[model samples]
Target chain A: MRNIKLTIEYDGKRYLGWQRLGDSEKTIQGKIESVIEQMTNEKIEIIGSGRTDAGAHAKGQAANFKTNSEMARNEMLAFFNRYLPGDIVVKKVEEMPERFHARYNVKGKQYSYYVWNDPIPTAFERYHSFYFPQTLDMDKMTAACEKLIGKHDFAGFSALKKTKKSTTRTIDDISIEREGSMLHFTFVGDGFLHKMVRILMGTILEIGAGKLELIVIDEIFETKVRENAGETVPAHGLFLDEVYY
Target chain B: MRNIKLTIEYDGKRYLGWQRLGDSEKTIQGKIESVIEQMTNEKIEIIGSGRTDAGAHAKGQAANFKTNSEMARNEMLAFFNRYLPGDIVVKKVEEMPERFHARYNVKGKQYSYYVWNDPIPTAFERYHSFYFPQTLDMDKMTAACEKLIGKHDFAGFSALKKTKKSTTRTIDDISIEREGSMLHFTFVGDGFLHKMVRILMGTILEIGAGKLELIVIDEIFETKVRENAGETVPAHGLFLDEVYY
Candidate 1:
């Protein structure tokens, strides 16, 4: 068997999520697996680097699967794209060593969230950005982001319903930038917990709006209580940008 | 009474067309009129620069309406955008002279057609671009575009169902540019016939594919027969860019 690595891009607007769940075929993984099974005439189990919730897009999501067919990289890319729907695309496909696993061998992942801070709405960019019309304090938001750039127990930033045993994760880098009427927050980390990015964004936004003090972030980080965290932002603005291994 | 000149933008994928038809309530103009009627408690008729077919988009469409309401430009812009659906936006509102008209006072217009020439489909840009996997000869396409640059009767390149009394239109400029895997064809003209840009793109694509010779363009122009023209391309790839007066 040959190990194949696939780079995927999806609009995630109508999907339930990335993982396959039961008989419902509304998930991204289910859609990809169904197309692959139809092409290979066999049941293929694919592993993704991580799960992105509904309405969270991805530009360079990585996945791996074992296949007996010795198709070329370009051929596989073309084949998958031909069968996939308009909202999902296989950007690239590569043959890897049999030991290369997409989930376990990942070095880092990057995510970005977009906010449209303009008073007027944009017709084309409505789906890809969150509309926040209120004025925000950029300096406070930046200060809060700087404090989040190190290793910490991100328990407070995750959803209360998450069942992950360990809540500690290291955030390698975090930066915020503004361009005209759009603000972008980029985060690089080894791994992320459930709804971690959204919760962090929500916390920063609260600080920016003067609803919470910037120093409150440290208290929440130390407490590790879900109630101390801010609200979770919407999922449409979050994008799983890339995976590096 | 104040005459308002509104700059509009829409993702026309959901609308039947720009014009209101038989109380369908699904047209772009119908949506705008309903919102205006609700805001002012009076029925107002809005005139657009031209009609865009279903699935066609607009970036800077121009329209004008006469209203007695003493609303400022900024307030009108904000109010219209708030009432309109997320897919449509009134970018700007200006109080123009009563003599100003969107359609009759227009001097020229610009339209652009985007073609994705990559082998793989693009997930994010699916609605805005046409995917063409075949290799195109850019030199042939450019040469054919040059033939259409000067003022000429574009009757042969328009749709056969067009019922305009005059079939003669002057094309001020036509250009075809290729940036990586994206091909953009822009046309500036005094007026355009129905589906003129799509047909022009189809004819140029035929020349690029070597299916039709460059000299056939002149023959079709002289014949002025719609049957001699190339096939009408799809509507989703066309964008009404701007209207100038």
Candidate 2:
């Protein structure tokens, strides 16, 4: 048995998300598994590092699967590229250690959300970025970013009311950059809860727009209540940029 | 009556090019015209700098329309943005001279074609770029670009068989740039014939792939036949980058 690791890039616009749900083949994982099943002629389960929400794109998503096929890495890569849809590409494939697990062995992740701040919508980025026509205060948003950094209880930011897993996660860094009318938010963290990034973006954008006070960040962190946070931004603007092992 | 010039930007993925076709609301010009007609309650024909082929995007496409409505520029800009589809945007709107015509009072144009040279597909730029999974010889392609410069009868490059209009047009400049796995070909010229940019891309790409020699450019020029040139590339990779007046 050989364990194969795959680096994937996908445009998540048409996908139901990364995870395979039931028999529905509208998912990113289902698409890849179907292609692999056709190539290997075997039923095999593929494990993803984590689930990206529906309509959320990924640049370097990691996955691994155990297969008994004798195909070489280059051959499998070629096969996947040839068979997989153009929107979902297997960027790299390699033989991994027998015990390697994509989900359990994930060390960290990086996510970036794009915001188009101009009054006029960006034609090309309409699907990929959040279009906020209102003016934003960059200075206030930058100041708020400092507060979001470091380890904190992100329960208020998640979509779920409660999770069996601990909600306390370390946000290594959060950087907000502005280039012309485009604002980019980059978040590096050990792990993220469901819709945590989107919620945080919503809250941060509200603060930038002066709708919410900057002190709301502290209130949300201490209370650990979902209602205390701002609205959950759309999944289209979020991208699972990188997954580190 | 006030003449309004609009600096337009569009994704073109969902558009049937920039021209307003008969009863087709899918075109970029048709969408904008509909919005204007709704706002002003009058049927106004919006003239574009030129027609981009179907599936061809634009960053700075210029258009002009005559309207009797005394709407301010800012108000008109907001109204168009609100009513237009998300994939199409009016970046800027300004009052123009009554005689200023988008198609007639022309100067030059800058068009760009994006090529994803790597085997792996781009996650974000899927619809905006062409995935050409072949090793390109930049040196050979550059040498060919030099030959393609200056005033030439580009009848061989166009898809149209016969036209009364002169086929001679001066190419101001052609520059090929590579950034990572993406190759951008920017062309500045007086005007392009039907599918001229795409045909040139196909021919140049063939030269880069070593399938066609650099001397084929000269032979195609002398023959003045479309059959002598390479295939016409896909329209999705082409962009009307800028329209200069």
Candidate 3:
């Protein structure tokens, strides 16, 4: 058996996310798993590095599945591209070691959020980006980012009410960039909890818009309560950028 | 009375070009005109700079209409952006001179074409760009562009069956640039016949792919026949970038 790793890119506008839910065809994982089952003639399960939410896009999502078929890497890649929808593309296929796993072996991940900080929304990018119709103070947002760049319990920033697992995670960097009327937020971290990035975006944008004070970051960190954080920004603006092994 | 000059941008994926046909509401012009009429309580015709084909996007499509309503420019702009569909946006609304017209007073136009020069199509931009699997020779395409520049009768490169008006047009420049797996084609010209840019793109890409020789451009110019030229690329990749007055 060979452990095949896949790097996938998808526009997740219509997908229910990267996990199969019963037998719904609107999920990214369901669609790919069904295609793989058809190709291999066996029940197969694909392990994603992270399960992104519905409507969130991915540029380099990593996944892995074990197979016994003796097909070339390029052929399997082409087969997936041919069978999958146009919005979901398997960018690369690699035969990994037997012990290689998609989720358990993950080292780090990168995520990006797009915000259109203009009075009006853009026509083409409205679906892919969040339209924040308020002027953002970059300095205020940058100050807020500084408060979150370290190992901390981000439980307050997650949408999950409670989890038994450890909520502490290491965030190596958080960069904020402005290009014209678009604000790009990049998050590099070891792992993120459910809705962590969206809530973080909401908290930072609220700070920049003067709705919340910079000290709210400290309050959230200390409280570790979901209600203490800002609202979760829409899923469409979020992107699973990359997964590193 | 006010003569309003509006700059518009739209994702033409669901639009039937920019012209109204009968009572169909699928056209961009029809949608905007109805919205304007709803706001002003009067029927008004929108004159677009060019009648783009179905699925052709526009970044800066110039249009104008005469109105007797006493609404301010900003108010009208906001109203249009509010009422029109999310895919269509009125970027700017200006009260122009009495004699200003969208079509007749145009000085020059700029168009852009996007080609994904790779084997697999991009998931995000599949609708906005053309996927070409063939490897393109940038030097050959650039040389073909040079042969077609300046004053020339581009009648052979049009999709129109026949036109009584002269097909002579001035092409100021055509630049081809490659960035990674994407090719960007920019065309600047005083005027263009119907489907001229699409045809020009197809011809040049064919030349770059070694399917057509460099002399084919000169032969098409002399022959003045639509059949003498290469195929017309799809309408989705074409973009009306700007209309300069």
Candidate 4:
């Protein structure tokens, strides 16, 4: 059996997300698997690095599947592009080692969220950005980002109530920058919990707006309470930028 | 009567461009007019600089309408933003001279066309750019662009079959530049004929691909035959970048 690693990019505006739901073709994984089934003529199960929430985009999402078909890499790539919807694209496909697994071998990930800071709504970026439509105090937001960088239990920042598994994760870096009328927040970490990035963005926005004090992040970190963080931001602004192995 | 000039921006993916058609609410002009009518409680006519084809976008389109309402500029701006679709925005509004017409007083205009040059389709920019998977020779395209500049009769470059008016037009400047995997073509001229920008892009693309000779532009200018130039590119890739008065 040959293991094929696929680099996927998708606009999740109309998709449920990266994971396959039973008997439903509305998800990104389901769409790709359907195309692969037609190409390989076999029922194959593909493993994704992780799942992104509904309406969350991905640029360099990784996945792997075992197929007995001997199709070349370029041929498979072309076939996938031809069959897949315009919003979802298989950027690259490569033959992986027999022991290689997409989900089990994931090392790190990077996510970026865009907040449109203009008072007037942006015509072109209506679908991709969170239209905050308010002035954001970047200095304070940047300070909050600095405080967020480190290994910590992010349970307070996630959507989960209580976790059986450890919520301790290492955030290698966090950067807040402005591009024109948009505020960009980039996070690189070992792993992220459910709705963790969105919650973090919400808290930062709240801090920027002076609705919450800068110390709220520290309070949430110490208390490990979900309600301490700000409300969860929309999923549309978030992007799974890169997945590393 | 106070004439309010509006600088408009819209994503033309859904609308029928910037012109109003019989009872159709899909046009950008129609949407603005309806909002203006509601604001003033009077049926008013709004004039645009020119008509952009259906599915064509605009960033700096200019329009003007007469109204007796003494609404402040900021108030009007806020009102327009609140009423207009999320894909459309009134960027600026200013009181203009009574005689200043949006169409008649136009001095120069600028339009831009975006071509995605990568093999893999862009996830974010899919709606904004034309996905041209084929390789484009920028040097050859630039050479073609250089030949296109100057005062010339652009009848052959337009989509119009017959015209009583003068087809003589002056192309002030043309710039072809690359930003990452996207090729941007900007054209500045006193005025453009129907589909003239799109036709020019198509011819330049052909020249870049070695499908047409560099001298075809000169040939089209000399012949003044509509069939001499290349095909018109899609409207989705074209944008009315700026309207100068």
Candidate 5:
């Protein structure tokens, strides 16, 4: 069997998420697998690096699958692109070593969230960004980002509950900057729990809007309570930028 | 009657152009008039700077309408933004002098067109740009732009039928540059004839792709025949960037 790595990009507006569910055709994984099955005439399952929430987009979602079919990498990429919907594109395909796994071999991930910090929402960015009507203080938000870097248990910023798996993740860096009319937040970390990036964005935005204080980050980290954090922003604003190996 | 001006931004994917045609309500002008009538309880019509083609977007399309209602400018702006669909946004509302006219007062206009020049089309830019998989020579495209600057008879570049109106227009500038993976074309002119920018883009791209020679621009201008020009690009990639008065 040949181990192949696939880099995927998708507009996740119409799909459920990156994971497959029982008898549901709305998942991105299911859609890709179905297309691959048609090309190879074999049952195949692709392992994604991680799952993105519904309505969240991906610029570079990494996945890997082992296949018995003797097809060239270029041919497979073309076949997949031809069969997949316009919203999903297989960017690149390469043969990897037999030991490579998309899910278990991940070293880091980078995510970005866009907030349109303006009173009037832009028509072009309506689907790609979150429209926040209230004015946000960049100074406050910049200050709040200081508390997020480094290794810490970010259970309070996530939606996971009573999990036996460890919730401690090492956040390497966090950057907040304005991109034209939108505020862009980028995170580089080893891994993130469910809704962690969004929750962090919501809390940072609230702090910028003066609804929360700087000390709230410390409090949430200490308490490890999901309710202690701020709102979970809409999924459309989040993007899985890249999955590292 | 008090005259007020509005600056609008729209996605244009769902609109049937900017002009109101007969009884059709799919136009951007018709939509705004309907919303204004509902708010003021009086029928109103807006005169736009010009008509944008169907499926073409706008960043700052200007329009003006007269109303007897003494609604505050800020209130009117808020009302339009609230009632309008998410794809149509009213960015600014101001009380203009009674002599101000959207169409007649235009001193200049700016338009931009985007072309995705890459092998893999990005899923996000599918609707916003025209995807040309072939590589292009920027030097060739830039050379073609020089022939387009200044005043000339653009009859061959337009879609106008036999008419008494002057086919000559002064082009102040034309710029072609790369913006990330996309090629951006900008035109600043006294005014543009129907489908002039798109047709110019089509001709210029052909030159870049080596499909058509640069001397064809001269032949088209000298002969003033529409059939001598290259293909007219799609409307979705065109945008009315600004209308200067």
Candidate 6:
């Protein structure tokens, strides 16, 4: 069976997350799978590189599926885009080796959280950014971010209710930068636990607001206690930027 | 009476137009007026610098109203923003002289039209830009734009059903530029008749697509007949960039 790789972009505001759930078909995977079944007249299971939470957007999500249809790559892309909703788009389609798996073959993933720090509220960017009217200390936030880089047990930063096999994850890079009225936090890691990015962003925001110190982050990581971590920021500000293999 | 000036921004996608319409309270002015009446408990009238058509967005639309609420400028700005819809924003509020009228004191206006000249359909910017898959002749479009600059009786380019007192208008500047996959056309003018910018954009797009010659634009303007003009483009891609006095 030929493996078809698809690059996806979606505005995840109205979704119930990427994974399929119950009889409710209001999911990104469910929508795509239903469209594929309709076109190919066959039931196929598509695997995604990662699952982004509800209200979290994506720009370059990767997925793979096996299909026997002899449709051209361009035609498949066009068909997927035509059938999908306006918020979701299949950017590219390519045929890969039979052993190619979207999840197993992933080398790393990058996520970004956006913060609108301007005093005045932004109407157009309300959905894409977390609005914080309070003044932030950028130096303190950057110091906290630097401590997050490299391999570490991210159990304290992730949600306590996660059922992952392990909480230890290797973070390749973490950087915080400000652009005009927006602050962007980018994290590249081998894998992320449930709500890990949002929780980390919340911790950084607390540090920036002078509520939590940089040493507090290290103490939480060392203690491996989820309760010691900062609150989980809302999902609307977080985005799955890219999945790399 | 002190004239309260408001610098406004709106998405305009859901509005009928800037002016109030019969039975339909979907106009931008109507929405603002309703909110103002609720805040001040008075029947307030707001005069806009120009009437933008339905689906035409604005970045710096100017308006003025007479209110004796004794509210500070910042309070007024904050109160309106809190009550207005997410798509509309009052950027700034200022106390002006009694003689300052939004409609009568306008010296010039700037409008911009965006065209997405990409083969792939865009999801996020679909509502804000016109999609033109075919390649355009930028040189030809630039030449045609140059001809549109300067004073002229734009009766041929204006909408046929308009009931304006004068069709003569002076365009101070016209610029057509391409950035990446988007083409932007900006017009600075003393005044514009109904659908003048849209009709001009349509004509330029036709010329860029090799359907018409550059000299044909001059011919249409010289004819002073509405039949000589091209079709009016959709209002979604057009924006009232700013109004100047």
Most accurate candidate by TM-score:
3
Compare the candidates by DockQ and give the number of the best one.
3
lDDT of 6 at B141: 86
The C-alpha TM-scores of every prediction are: 0.92, 0.97, 0.99, 0.98, 0.98, 0.94
Off by over 4 Å in 6: A160-164, B160-164, B177-179
For model 1 the local lDDT of residue A182 reads: 89
lDDT of 4 by residue, B1-245 (tens): 79999999999999887899985599999999999988888799899999999999999999999998988999999999998888899999998988999999999999999999887888777777888878778888989988888889999999887879999889989998888989899999999999999999999998888888899988989888767677788999999999999
Q: Which lDDT values do the candidates have, in the order given?
A: 0.88, 0.90, 0.92, 0.91, 0.92, 0.86
- Prediction-by-prediction clash tally: 0, 0, 0, 0, 0, 0
A76-120 in candidate 4: lDDT tens per residue? Answer: 998998999889999999999999999989999999999999877
Task: Give the per-residue lDDT digits (tens) of candidate 2, residues A8-72.
Answer: 98889998999999864789999999998999999988999999999999999999999999998
TM-score: model 5 vs. ground truth: 0.98
All models, DockQ values?
Answer: 0.79, 0.81, 0.83, 0.78, 0.82, 0.52
Could you tell me the lDDT of residue A55 within candidate 4? Answer: 94
Query: What lDDT does candidate 4 reach at residue A214?
Result: 98
lDDT of 1 by residue, B141-237 (tens): 9899889887777888887565658877788888888887889999999999888899998888888888789988999889887776667888889
**Clashing residue pairs in candidate 5 (N, C-alpha, C atoms within 3 angstroms):** none
* Model 2 lDDT tens row, B33-118: 98999999999888899999889999999999998999899999999888888888898999988999999988899999999998
Model 2, residue A85: displacement in angstroms? Answer: 2.1
Per-candidate TM-score, chain A: 0.96, 0.97, 0.98, 0.98, 0.98, 0.96
Pitting candidate 2 against candidate 3, the one with the higher DockQ is: 3
- Give the lDDT ranking, best first: 3, 5, 4, 2, 1, 6
lDDT of 5: 0.92
Per-residue CA lDDT of candidate 5, range A3-22, in tens? 98999999999999999998
Stretches of model 4 off by over 4 angstroms after superposition: none
Model 6 agreement with the true structure over B1-245: per-residue lDDT tens digits: 56799988888888887898874379989988888898778899899998999988998899999987887888888888899987888989999998999999999999999998876666666667888778899888888888999988888898756555778899999898788788889999999988999999988898889887787777877777766666788999998989999
